[model samples]
Every structure is written in C-alpha cells, then in structure tokens.
Target: MKNYIVILLTLITALVSAQSTRKYSNEFMNIGVDAAALGMSNAVVSHTADVNSGYWNPAGLVHLEDNQLSLMHSSYFANIANYNYIGYGMSLDDRSAVGISLIRFGVDDILDTTQLIDDEGNINYDRISTFSTADYGLTFSYARKLPLDGLNFGVNAKIIRRIIGDFASSWGFGLDAGIQFENNSGWKFGIMARDITTTYNAWSIDEEKFEQISGAVDGQNQELPETTEITIPKLEIGMSKKWIFNYDYSLLAAANLNVRFEENNDIFSTSFASINPALGFEFGYTDLVFLRGGVGNFQNERQIDDSENLTFQPNFGVGFKYKGIQIDYAFTDIGDQSAALYSNVFSLKIDFSIFR
Candidate 1:
C-alpha cells in the first residue's frame, strides 16, 4: 500500500507540473456554479439574471431587484473532490449592481508517503502524513445598465489561488468583461469574455518539501517546475427566449456558443478557434416550480480501437421557489458521454427582502 501511495503522489505532482505548460490553466474555475446553470449544461449566459450572474455573465447582475445571496456545493471524482461556492449581490441603484463571490475546489487528506521509507529502507507508518490540494477563486463584479434600452455591461476582477499542500503554491490575476442586450420581442443576447487580459499565475515551490519527493522517481522532478503559467482569453455567446402559456405555465429556451482560441475536438474546430454549442430548456409552472435539461460538451472522443466517436454531456435539474427563496438540484457528469459516474449538485438562493 505504501508503494501505491508513493506512485499516486508522484503522478499527482507530474500532472500539476504538466498543467503549468498547458493552455487550460486554472481549469477549476471552468466547472460552472449554480445547479440551475450546471443542469442546463452552462447555457445560461443570456438569462442568468441573479446573484449567480457574477460567474455566468456579470451583466445579468444589473437585473437584481434586491440584495441576494447564493450558495452551491458539489462533489466530483466519486467524492474525492469538493467544490463549494458563495456569492452576494445587491443593486447599487436601479441601474447598477455589485457582487462578490468565492469558489473553492479541493481534494483533502491525501496521504503523503514520501517520507514513509527512511534512509534505512524500513517502512514506518508513523512517518506517513497527509495534505491537500486546492484551488480558490475570488471575484469582484460590477454591472451597470447602459443608456440604451435593455443594454447592460459588466466587468470582473479576479484573483486566483492554488495550493498543493506545502510543496507548491501560486497566485494569479485576471479580468473578464461581458455585455447583454434584450429586445422588445423578449429575445436576450449575451457575450462573455473570460480572462480578457490574459491571466497569469506565478508559482512558488518549496525546495525542501519538493526534494523529499524529487527522488521518488528517476528522471522526474529533477528540475524545478515552470514558475509562470498563462491563460488566454475564451469567449461565450448566448441567446435565450421565454414563452408563457395559459397564464400559469412558461418555457425558456437558451443556447450558447463556447469558443476557445485553439484547435481542439469541439464540434466546430479550426486552427484559430474551436466552438462548442449547448442548448437548454426550462419549464416552469406559475413561476414557482421548474424543470430543466440541457446537452453540451460536444467532442470527438477517441476509442481504444483508434476510431473517433461523437460524445456529449447531458444534464437535468429541478428548482422550487417561494417567498423569495429558491432551492435547486442537478444531476450532471464531470466527464462527457464517455464516463459513467455522475455528480449531484445543490444550490440555494435567498433574497434579503424575504426577511422584510
């Protein structure tokens, strides 16, 4: 078991170091928030008009009618990882809003077996320790209604923190911008630019702790990992419309085009950028009970036989609202159609006016 633990730790370290050189830095932030949004496969950019908008599309925050708070929690990788989020938003006035949000994704109590076998080559359970790896995101968002009717804009100032126990850590900074527009016909359109200024993370590794595992595997950990990581900008465009029937039933349809500036397996791939399309729907009864579903993450997955197959993720969710408070639940998968395990997500939202 000790040998297995050492191998696991080494693999984790290698993966961390490899990420520093990849285009998807700070990926934990991409794991959407709000169960409602996740259930819709993150196709809510055009209609996320609440506190959670601070993450999906800040411009939606301008629609806030009162001070609001939101919370969400989800477990991933068969409960080996925990993702938590909290957010607060309030109208600064009829035309402006401000919000603050924090997100954390972590794996805790990982066995550190680097020191389990000392110089004498003797196994010592007492020397075994544990540590955790986590990533945190703090965002300050501001939104304002533009002079034009049904136009709003927003910006996000983000700070990122990442830790791998006492072995490595990093701090990053970035900016995001978004805009939304609604037409008299009830058509909503939105655009969100993430890491608009190109986020950068600077890492600091403790040589002492690193050395303990440096020799765990030959030809590995011989060099100090890259000290800097960069994340380029990504864009998402969305559209949505809502229809009411019988004065007691309603339906909302939303779609999103997610773009990354690189070639990938997305349905629409190119050297300049790749686009993944998502579609979602929500059915509501008397504006109190809701059911939602979506499909997204289109990709060409490779099979063991070296053939490529199209795959996507499907999500479903339900919500209830009353007296300015809401509860939501979602069944989602972290991996696309290729994986078997699914995660449960839950979220709560409250309007301060509920207390008044």
Candidate 2:
C-alpha cells in the first residue's frame, strides 16, 4: 500500500512540475492517431505490447513475449473515417525480435460539389458528387535487448503514402526510435522520438495543377489547384511505476511528456502529458477467463468531467484472456478542442506465442 502511494505521489509531482502552458500544432496534424492510442489518451511508451507498439511505442517491440500476430480495426470520430491495422512480431531467437505493421485511414463517399450557372443569366445546375480518399503506411521495426539485463532499445522506419480519388498520389518516409527499461521492482521508464523527418513532399504535387492556379490560361478540367504539403516533427517521453498489491491485484500508474514543433507556424510549445494513471487487476476466474479494468485522467483544453461518456476525463477499459488469446477495449477522446469528437474508441487485441 505504501509503495502504491509513493508511486502516485511521484507521478503527480512529475505532472505538476512539468506542466507546460504553451500553444501547439495546427488542426490537421494534431488529430492523427490509431484507435488504441486514442483509447488511453495515448498513454503509451512504458506499457508496450500488441501491434499498437508500431504507433505508440516502437521500443515496446522489445517486450514481445511470443511469436504472435495481431489484427485491429477501429472506427474513429463516430465513423467519420475508418482505420485499419495489421501487426506481426516474432522472436527470431532468444536475443532478438522483429515486427511489421501496416496502417490505413480512409474517408469514403465524400460529397464533391460544383456550382455551374448558365450564360442566360440563370442558374443551370448544382453538381453533388462523391469521391473516396485514403492514406496508407507501412512500418518495419527491429528491437534487441542488450545482453546487459534491463536495457532494451528499438527502432522503426516507415513508408507513408497518400491517395486522393485518383487525382494525385504522393509518398514520404519517416523514422522512430525508442529506449526503455524495467526493473524487477516495477519501476519503468522510456523515451521515444517520432517524425524525425518532414513527412510529406511538395515536389509530388501535380505540375498540371500549378499552371491553373498561377492564372496561366489552361483548358477546362486540365488544371487543378496546388497547396503546400505540411508535415511536423513530434517527440514524446514517458515514465511509469507499478506495484504488485498482491498476486491477484496490482496498481499501475504512468505519465508522459510531449514536445511538438511546426515548421510553418514558427511555434514552439509543450503539452505536459495528460498524466495518464490507471489501476488494473487480474483474476483468473476459471483459469480460462481473466478480467481487467481501471481509470485514468486525460489532459485537455477543457475540463473533461466524464470519462465513461467520452466527455474526456479519466479513461476506463476491460480485457479478457482465453487460450493464449487476449482482447481489450477502451473509451477515450481525440481532439483538444470543440471538434465534436466526444466518442469512445473500440480496440481488439489478440496475443499468442509459440516457439518452434
């Protein structure tokens, strides 16, 4: 009991002392996240498992306990878009593990509109059209724990591509690096850096679109508009501590710090991680079924008093394990403003390991 209290105090101290009141990223980049990350308010970096490691904490790859593969699909913002993921991680030997994951975000059947007027000073027709757009990414990860116990590190590099209704396609690449450590006593720490490169390309813009936007006379439908592609750099650091209250129940707590930079905004700022703290306990009710649950807070621009309804405060989740398989679910938020994103994310996790 004392250990749990100490851990809680330490985490609160870290959050209070480290809170940053600076402004940050623009709307577009601020909203990118997979379902699992969104569920915990993205409180990852220390607890690494499942395929979510590809996005939340690459270093988590070091903890892959089995030769397992997982597939997850999430609907975000009340079905505003679709997010799909597939992850595979396997231990090549006792000393190393390799992982691969693919993520895709798609927006479907969007209304495309065009207003046309007749030369006879009368409104002719309004065109209501639809198109589909998507962004896909592939990441390859490698992790190795040094022979020295408790020292683990990993890295990931990803290829990202964007497609817009056959109008255009562009690709870019980025890298992620992470380091983590866990002591037998339950003290855990980790740091991860992501988006080490400008993630998009200006050169990929269709040249044909440039001529029309420049006011150079061009044929109808032959020219489109051109806009600059913007990508920003994001860095995150986190720490956590857990206490084995007993064999069946344990208390866990964690916190994270994020530093974000935008090239175009000339803005530099920090968001003290929302101080994610959760309590989880496991009970093997019948040696075939296990149950888990907890609560935690989410940092935000407004006061989030309700976590269950996704009004954005503390988060809650449940998980079950059966026959080498585990499935988990969580409810959380995505936007920092009045983005009408008050909803819970659904995440399905499966774990299985076999050595052959």
Candidate 3:
C-alpha cells in the first residue's frame, strides 16, 4: 500500500508540475463532496434537492422545503487517506434558503524521515517523527426563487485552507454561482460556474523546515519555489428527465457537460479545449430503495493515450430511506489497476418539515 501511495503521489506531482506557464492549485477542490452525487459520477447538478445540494448546484437548495442535515465520509485510494463532508440547509423564508457545507481531507500519521539515517549510515528508529496533513473548506450558500415559477438562483462563498505537517500552509477564497430551472413535467436544467472569481492560494512556508529539507537532500537547491497558484473558472451545464411508472417506481436519467478555458502556451493564449461529459441514471422503488450507476471522464477519442485507452471509469451506488432518514453508499473506479486507486463512500442524511 505504501508503494502504491508513492506511485500515486508521483503521478499527482507530475500532473501539477506539468508546465510553468500553466500552473494551477488546490485540485482537491474538484473532488465530489456528497456520496450520492459522486455515485452518479457527479451528474447531480440538475436533479439534486437536499442539504448536500449546495455542493452540486446551490440553486437546487431552494427545492428543499424542509430543514436538512447531511454527513459523508470516504476511504480514498484504498484507505491511504480520508475525506469527509457535512452540510446543513434551512429555509429562511418561502422565497429564499441558506446552506452551510464543510469538507475535510487528510492523511494521518505520516512518518517523518529527516532523522532516520545516521551519519555512520545506520538507521535510527527513535529519531523518526510522525505528523498529519490536512485540507479544509467551508462554504456558505444562499438560494432564492425567481419571481417566475420554477426558477432559482444561488451563490456560494468558500474559504479554503491547507496544512502540510505544520511546515507549510495556505489560505484561499473562491466564489461560485448557479441557476436551475424546473417545470411540472419532471424536466430540469441547471448551469453552474465554479471558481468564477478565480480562486487563489497563497502559501506560507516555514523557512527553517525548508532549509532542513534542503540540507537533507544534500543542498540540491538553495531556494524554495513559488507557492502561489490560481484556479481558473469551470462551467457546467446539466439536464435531466424523469419517468414514473405505476406511481410506485421512478427512473431518472441525467447528463452534464463541463467546459473550462485553458492557456495554449501562456496565460494569454486561452481557449476552451477542456471538455468532459458525464452520464448517470437512477431508479427508485416506492421511494424506499434506490439504485444508481454513472459513467464520467469521457474524453475525446483523439486525446486517448496508450495508458488510458484500455481502462474504464464507472461508478455505482445504493441508498435506503426510512422515515426521513437516508443512508447512501457509493463506489468509484479509479482506472489505474497498478495503483489500486478505488474509493468507497458512505453518507447519512436527515430531513424534517419546517412547517411542522
């Protein structure tokens, strides 16, 4: 497992270190927060209506008439790390609602090896240290119904923070906006703009710790690298349709298209070549048990490389609801067999009618 984690870290480092001209940060922000949504390959932008809706499309929160609370925890990458999420939503009035959400991702008990090797080339077990690294984010969301029927708009303000074993830390801020349209015919549409204001992370590194790392690496470099990056805006469009059978069974199909602008060579040469599409389906039996399946990361065939050509990425989930309480489980395929990069998620939610 440790070797697999090392390989995964290498792949992550290579992706982030791609080009000096096109740098980005806080990629973890893109991970899905709700197990139910992630089980649908993050295709819930159009059809979601729960406390966790703020994470997918804040506008969907207006559809929730009752006070709701949600919690989710996941074992990521074969138990190498942990991810958790929590959300609460309450209607402020008949026309507007508010939601709060939090996310925590971390790795605990990491062995610090700065003192493991002695000057005589002997191992020193007592000199090793352990530390934890984590990332946290809090989001406040507000959604209001439009004067027109079945239309809603929302915004999210997010504050993000990251810690690297007490040696390095960063703070960031971002804004997101979304709109949803629904009708009486079980048709829904949604649009969301994530990081519309361009999130920026400013990192502060402990100079002494960095100097110690430099010395341990035999003085390979005299100075540390830059610690600032900006996350560009991403736009998503989603649509969904539902069908009811015999008044006891319901099936819904949804899809989403994501588009983001990226620079060709420099920050100025911008284009919209980054496109990813996802598909999801869900079936509910008497509104008690639900089954879901989804497929995502659908890139163009021309962009497929040798390593990515033979892999499949799909997700599945199941849920049970009883007396306003719900439990959901999701599984995601990571597409890399050698790295064993799969994940499991579990979530719980409760709702109560505000009118009551």
Candidate 4:
C-alpha cells in the first residue's frame, strides 16, 4: 500500500511537470463511450467493474461475476456528431471472461459541394449535394486472473473501418492490452496500452471524380495521392481507493495519467508527452443510487497568466439501478471556445446474473 501511494504521487507530479505535445491520428478512439465512465472523466482504468470496461481496460472484465450488456449514445460536440457504443461480457469460468464491443462515430447530412459559381458568376444551390462520413470498430477481448490471486491480465483485438460517403474508405487493425491489480485493502491499480500495435488507416480517394467536378477551370489543379495514417500508441495509468462507510454507503476516489508516444510538432522527433490528467469521485447510497463528478484535461491551458485555463473541463452525472436494469446520464462542458457546446450522454446496462 505504501508503494502504491508513492507511485501514485510520482505519477501526479510527472503529469503536472511534463510538457504537453501534439496529438495523433484517429482522435475518435480517445472519446469515451459509456456515460458512467465519461461522467467520471474517463478515469475508470482502475475501477472498471461494469461491462463498459471492455472498451477501457479489458483486464477489469475479470472482476465481472455475471453476464452483462451495455449500450450508450451521445450527442457529441453540441450535436455536430453522433457517438454510440455496445458491449457484452460473460464469465467463462471462475477466473476467465470474454467480451465483445462495437463503436460508431458519424456525422450525417453533410453538404457535398461541387461548384460554388458558374462561368456567369451566379450562385446555384441546385448543384450542391450531400453525403455523410462514418467510423466504426469491432473488438474482441479476453481476460483472466493470474497465478497471483489479486492480479489480472487481458488483451483485445480490433478491426477499424472509415468511410467518406462512397468516394473513399479505409480498413485497419490493431491490438490493446492491459493489467490490473487489487487488494482487500480497497486499493486498485491499472495500466492500459491503447493501440499497442499502432493502428493504421489507408485512404483511397476517387481523384478523377473530384478533379472533374471541382478542379480549376484554367487546368491548374493538383492531384490527390493515396495516403496512410498511423495512430500513435497511448499509455494510461490509474489508481483508485474505495472507502466503505458502514454497510449502505461507500465513496470512491480515482486518478489517471495519460501519455502518448508520437512525433513532436517537428514530425521527426518522437517521444512521450503527458497529455492530460483526470480526477474523479463517486458516491453510492444503498447500492441503488449513485452520484459522480470529475475534472479532466488539466494540461491544455490556453493562457499562461489567466490562472484558470479554458481547456480544463468539469463533468457530472447520475445513475440508478433497479433489479437487472441500470440507467445513467452525464453532462460535460467541452466547449472552451463557447458555452453552447456542452454535450449529454446516456447509457443503459443490463445484468443477467439473476437468471443463473
């Protein structure tokens, strides 16, 4: 326990002292799925006792003693995009579990413009068209307890697909792995490696059609080239401590540190930089009702002298469970640039252990 405390303090110090860096590709992968997790600022790496753990840290799935299914939907970026997730987990035996998860992020009703003006220099609304963009992923996960009673390990394999209407598409694959350790003293620690295999997206564009419709009239158009983007690896470490107040009340506190390994702004210098640190708390009453809140993105300060940065955000949520059904809702202010850009996320979870 002393060692864990020391490690947690060390990580917190590093998170505050390290310099921030540029981000990587496939940013949608970083978006949190379930409301319960997001409400706590995505600090669930050490406390994933629900089916949604399949998306955060698969090693936490070994803690599930029942079959479970979870679904979530969010109005992201002030309804500019839609995000959804589905996951199911089942215990294979006393110490083994398996799970599957799916993710979708899309923007619909996008205007596909062909030309803004004609040779007569007049606007033509009839010539404008529309198309949508989408991203999808399917993941399979497995987890098991290690020989050490309190240790667990897990791995996930995933397939990724991205589509831009019918003009271009890409397919990619990746792997993730995680480890978790816990004790009867209410201390839990976790580490997760996202995109450990370095996922890639190979884009193919319909250059001929693009050039024919939008190329310069004077024949000075540049050609499009096929390109591939690789998602950099991200590492997260977290710790949580649970405090039980008698039999009907409990409080939990958790913290997480996120670091990404990718090329710097120079595009040639590659290193790991601390991205953001998150802190969260949850309070439960009678095991039926819960309240959650968290603070995240403490690293991206827009101003150095303002003392309070625009990048810092706060999230809050509420949840309840009845029989086999659980419902959750979360709200977060993600708009540092504007106040109208807040978002809401909702999730439903079902546990089938009673049937057995």
Candidate 1 per-residue lDDT over residues 1-356, each given as its tens digit: 23422443343334334432555689999999999998898999989999999999999999999999999999988899999999999999999999999999999999999988888889999999999999999999999998889888898999999999999999999988888888999999888878876778999999978877897876266777788888877888899999999999999999999987778999999876789999999999998999999999989877899998998899999999999999999997544474646889999999999988
* Model 4 TM-score, 2 decimals: 0.84
Q: Write the per-residue lDDT of candidate 2 for residues 1-356, one digit (tens) a residue.
A: 23432543444344335423322212233333444444444556676654556566666776677766666566766788877777777766766678888778889997643323333546544644567878778889887786668766677887777776645676767666676777788777766666554354432555653433333233344444443343444556666775554465554556665554422211222343322233323334443443333233322332366432222344444556565665656554323423355555455556664223
- How much lDDT does each candidate structure score? 0.89, 0.55, 0.79, 0.79
lDDT of each residue in 44-132, candidate 3, tens digit only: 88878779878888888887878999999987766878888889998888888999999999999999887798878899899999999
Model 3 residue runs over 4 Å out of place are 1-22, 117-123, 263-271, 300-312, 334-340, 353-356
**Residues 45-126 of candidate 4: C-alpha lDDT, one tens digit per residue:** 9878768878899998988889999999987666889998899999999898999999999999898655556778788988
Off by over 4 Å in 1: 1-22, 218-221, 334-336
Q: How well does model 3 score by local distance difference test? A: 0.79
Q: Which stretches of candidate 2 lie over 4 Å from their true place?
A: 1-37, 115-129, 203-230, 262-313, 333-340, 354-356
Q: Give the number of the best model, judged by lDDT.
A: 1
lDDT of model 4 at position 318: 89
Clashing pairs in 1: none
TM-score of each: 0.92, 0.69, 0.85, 0.84
Whose TM-score is higher: candidate 3's or candidate 4's?
Answer: 3
Q: Rank the candidates by lDDT, best first.
A: 1, 3, 4, 2
Pairs that clash in candidate 2: 296-314
